[model samples]
Structures are given as C-alpha cells and as structure tokens.
Target: MRRTLGRMLADSRTQPAHAPGASNDPLILREARADDMPAVLDIYNAEVRTSTSTYQYAERTLDEQLALLSSKQTAGDPFVLAELADGSVGGYATYGPFRPREGWRFTVEHSVYLREDCRGKGIARPLMRHIMGHAKARGFHSMVGVVDASNAASIRMHQAMGFQVAGVMREGGYKFDRWLDCAFLQALL
Candidate 1:
C-alpha cells in the first residue's frame, strides 16, 4: 500500500531535528507542492545543461516538470523536496519503477539532486534517508542508483549510505558529445 503525502510529512516531523547533512538551520524533507515546481525545474534544467547526471540534452519546461510530479503523486510514488531554513527548495529525491515488468515490482530506481550552492551542507544525506525510508515503508525490497562512474562525490555518498556497487556499464550513456559510463549501486531494504 502507498502512503499519503500528508502522512509522510507528519512522520518526518517526528524524526530527529538534525540528521546527517543537517545543521543549526531547520531542514524539512516533505512532499513537494505545485508552487515548488519552478525551483525544481531550475535545478533539473541546470543538470541537463551542465552535468551528466541526466542524459536529457533539452531543458524541461515548468509544465512538463509539473506533469511529471503529478504523475508520481498519482502513482503513489515517493517524490520528496528538501526545504532549507530560509524556505528555499534546495534539493529533491524520488523513486520510480526500475522496470515495467511485473517481476521488477519489488525493485525501484531512485535519484537525488541538490542545488549547486547547497552541496556539502549536510542536506543530501538526510534527504536520501527520507527517500530510503519511504521506499522501505512502501515495501520495496531493493533501491538502486544509477550514477555516472566519474562522479566521485555521488559514488562516495551512495557508498556511505550502504549501497553496494552492483556493476558498471561502459559507454552506457551519451552526453556532452561523448559516451559516459554508468555505475549501478543497490541497497536491499
């Protein structure tokens, strides 16, 4: 069974005031609202334009991002946003079906992103923990992260979170006029 956003938000409030990647500032990890789409889109589009985090070369519009968020909500998938003390939408994490086949129902692929300035501030760790908790609560048996092999920070972060490197696919993606290798990491819930 899927959990409601309200329930998830309420549950987050009951957790420790400061988890990893959190500091003196009040950090909130909760379901995203419609008004949050612009900030979310900005972060995503920045990645699309400048990073190999996503293979999408074209930037996504606000409507498209909003639609995707809506789809996640409709499917009861976890899509969480991280709010900094100043109320800025600094990052987000989400999970979706790893594959469409029925046998893959117990597995999900997850992703996390943070604003450029928000990195190294102890935000992603707690945000990712919230995502993992949600996935586990929703009965997922495994969570996978497909990260770029060259992205040391992300790789190390996943490793710190107990995700084991499952395998690597050389030249698995194309971006920036080159082929990029992808490393897959998995954590059993």
Candidate 2:
C-alpha cells in the first residue's frame, strides 16, 4: 500500500502508543510538534558529536532547534518524527528548499537522524519514503540527500528508494580534524 501524509497523520491520531504485552513494537511516523524538539535535538546533537553524517562542529542549541522547528512548521515544510510504539522518539527526518533561488522551488534537500540505539532497526527507509510521498504531494519534483561519502548503508538505502548518486564533492566538509567528502543523491518525485 502507498504511504501518504494524510494516512500517517490519521494513524498517528488513532493508534494507541502501545498494546500491553505486545512483543513487537511498530514504527509510527508523524508530523513533528514543538514538544518533540527536545528528542529531535538530542538525536541530531549526538550525530554532531560522534559522526561525519553532519559537518557541523558545534552541537546545536535547543533554542536554535526550537526556532528551526517553528520555521519549518510555519513554512509548511516537512519536519517529521519517527516514534516507537511505546511513544519514545527514535529519530526524525526533515527537508527544506535545496536552495533559495526561485528555480529551485521544485527541489528539496533532506536530513535524517536516528538515535544511537535505533540504528539497524529498519526505521530510516520508511521515514524517507514518507518524506518523498509527502513532498510529491506538495508538488515537489525531486528530493536530495547529502550523505557522507563513507556512509554506504545510507547510500544503499537511498538507492533502494530510487535515489541515484548525482555527484560527489571531495573534501567539501571538514569535521573531526579531517576532511569529509559529501555525496549528493537525488530521486525524482
């Protein structure tokens, strides 16, 4: 079945956080609210500290995160959260205009961050699929992901979702006392 924002939003509204004694926990994708900022920020900041996934050197402040959340919400951009069946925030995905130029209106660049413990749990693929469906519904023509060159798992996942590597910028980013290459992966809506 196709995933749509409307369907996910409805599911978010109706699904209970968890069923008592349930052995398997389902993944839930929903629009992020202001209250979700703390959890989202924690996931992002952890990546900032330990990974090359983001080129940022300093950890993001909560106020800054709050402002970003507010802006995305106001602009109707997709800023979504992925929660466990127990209602704990495990990850988040968001996208914004690829560039400020008018011609770039139909393109977006996205980011996904998952908590350390959430890796390999099959969360990212669904979150990305949701973002693509949501963006396509909003009239976007393409979505891009700028992933670290060394992140083969992420590249493979995007490839599975129909994204292709468009280009690579060698040593385009610096973090952790070394240069990092960034690969641009694009998918048509």
Best by TM-score: 1
Q: List TM-score per model, in order.
A: 0.86, 0.85
Clash count (model 2, backbone only): 0
Worst 10 residues of 1 by lDDT: 1-10
In model 2, pairs of residues that clash are: none
Q: lDDT tens digits, residues 1-189, model 2?
A: 113322322333343221112123378889988888889888998898899999888998989999999899888888988889779898989999999999999999999888899988878877887788888889999899898877877776676667776777878998888888787878778
**lDDT by residue for model 1 (47-119), tens:** 9999999888999999999899999999998789899878999999999999999999999999899999998
Candidate 2 ranges beyond 4 A from true positions: 1-25
Report the error of model 1 at residue 135, Å. 0.8
Best by lDDT: 1
How many clashes does each candidate structure show, in the order listed? 1, 0
